[model samples]
Target: MTTAPKVALVTGATQGLGLALVEGLARRLAPDDTVYLTGRDAGRVAEAVRAVPGGGARVRGELLDVADPEAAALLAGRLEERHGGVDIVFNNAVMRVGPDDDPREIIDGYAEVNNFGTTRVLRAFGPLLRDGGRLIVVASSLGTLHHLAPVLHDRFDGLASLDEVDEQTAAWRDAVKDGTARSGAWPGFVNIPSKIAQVAAVRALAERRRERDAARGVLLAAVCPGMLNTPTSALWWDVGDAATPAQGAVPLLDLALGPVDPDHYGQLVRHGKVVPWRP
Candidate 1:
């Protein structure tokens, strides 16, 4: 008997890790399988879709700026209309405004793109995921609370659960709203706090995925691909032995195809190690 082709939707596929993921999945999936390669630029999306390993009609490109809630919903609607449902949803797009940008703007942008964007994608495609379908969130070790102590100067290592992070975010949000949020602290930018908030949001999504049984038994996982020498990281001073985009795609592919297990669900996997995350 022939198996049904799995449908995958990858955002930010114009280049870097997202592009590599589209290519990897294109090579692994059957001809009938559909892969939606998306990016902020239409031309870039088209180019990335065309650059996939195989020259087949199976791969298609779409213009998607995940930060735009309406655009995300529209993409989902299009997918639903065309394929009825999708088997995999990859939330791979992220925004890192340069160091020179206004700190508040940077934080707001990251919060919109990294945190709300993932939530929008999940909300849009949740109904489209097939039973036992997979949802992969391409995160970074920087977002891992466990790694925060060692990586982020031991500032807030005590944040272990989504609730704790939520409380922290709420406090910051309140501070900002009340005109008390600091603007002169170390890493004195809203971006850092936003990153922490994004991680917390990811954890909350995982928890919700685990609790909901009607959503095709979705297995949500956040993956940290390590520091990749992609164009996105060029602005950073020290990327630290950045790996090729192909290398960064490994964990994503593994998470996409791995067996469904509760232990793996909502977990953050990086460097072949399953970093702890809320269930």
Candidate 2:
């Protein structure tokens, strides 16, 4: 009997790192395999699927906003019914902070999609993950504990549950709004905490689902794709010579399809290796 084809899905894949992931998957997966790329905009999703390498014959696009639990659930049901289950899931959806954006606004609103949205996707599609499947979250090196003060390290390291991470995130956001964030030694950059929460969620989920994931041979991980010359990066810094999205997708693709190393699960990875959360 012929081996079954793998089914992979990517969120927020209309452009940037997410888009790069679809392109890379198109190249790596067998021609018979299917790759699903989703974004909130149907037109962009269609356009992105059309532009994939090899004319995107094996790729499909869907309208999915990670923040919309209903849409996520519907898509999960559809994938389960049509493909049996998904073999790889790349959670790449993120609402980036703009140069002039309000700090409090980034925390309150963006977190809905950036931090919590990821958790939404996980809960929705996690059960449908096939045996030996991989779930990868595209986080950032800026989210690492090394960027935060030593006083805050223990708190983040000790986060054992999703609720704990959420509570900590809420407190951080409140601090920023009240001008006590700096006094509390939180990083000045708003994106840092958001990314930190994103990464922490991965660890918390991995710990909570350790037995289930182990029995099903599922792998969960978060990764920093590195600085890339994308519109999101352009919002904060000069693009000059920064790695392109295609280049940045390398590490992400590795985590998505590389050999399973339990040690790397729940860790933030970059350049094909686990990045230490602290010095």
Candidate 3:
């Protein structure tokens, strides 16, 4: 008997790791399977689809801004109507700011796009994930709980729901804006809190929807692709001999399409291994 066609969705696929994910999926999936690559810019989305390895009719492009819930919902609806449901979903959209940028703006920007935006995408696309599907959130290594103070560890480690995660992230942002972040024992770096929130969201979501996910065998994981030689990495640190975007995408591709490990769900994984959340 012939296997059914699979459907995949990858956010922020116009460039870098996201782009590589689209390419990897395109090459790995059967030709009849559909791989949807999304980006905010229509032009870039079209270009990325065209640039995928062995580009074919199976590769499709769509315009999506993860920060926009309406757009995500609409896209999910289209996928449901067209393909019945999605087999794989990769949340790869992100935003970063330089040190010189305003702390409040940086915090809010990251929170909106990287933290809450991740949750929004999950909420919209999660229900559409077919049985035995995978949902991978592209987080950063800096998003670990150990990066924060011990006092803050339980707050994140104990996240049981998305609402709680939101409250924690909001509290961190408020502390920063009110000049109490340092005293509150939260990390001073603007990106750390948001990244922490992103990972925490994944953990919380898994906990909140454990029963439903278990029945469907849907896997949820937060992944750190590690530092890559992308433009975003170059702007923040010296990436001498860093893994290329394609190389960094290896683990991500594996997680997206490889064997499902029940232990990996709701945890942060790197290089095909689970990374400790706490120090």
The candidate that achieves the highest TM-score relative to the unseen native structure: 3
lDDT of 2 by residue, 61-179 (tens): 98898777587889999999998999999999988888787786566677778877887887878788888899888888887888888888776675888778878877887888887
How many clashes in candidate 3? Answer: 0
Encode model 1's per-residue lDDT on 1-279: one tens digit a residue. 976777898987888888888888887777889888999998888777767878532788999998786999998898888878888888888887676875444555566677667767877887678877887778766565543334343333344545554456555555554445554233444545555555565566665556773345677777788788865577865666878899889867877867665666666677657776321
Provide the TM-score for each candidate, comma-separated: 0.81, 0.91, 0.93
lDDT of 3 by residue, 49-162 (tens): 878878432889999987775888899998899988899999998876776777765676667777777888888888888888998999888889778888778777877888
| Predicted structure 2: clash tally | 0
Q: Relative to the unseen true structure, what is the C-alpha lDDT of residue 12 in candidate 1, on a scale of 0 to 100?
A: 76
Model 1 lowest lDDT segment of ten:
147-156
Clashing pairs in 1: none
Worst 10 residues of 2 by lDDT: 102-111
Q: What is the lDDT of residue 188 in candidate 1?
A: 48
lDDT of each: 0.70, 0.84, 0.84
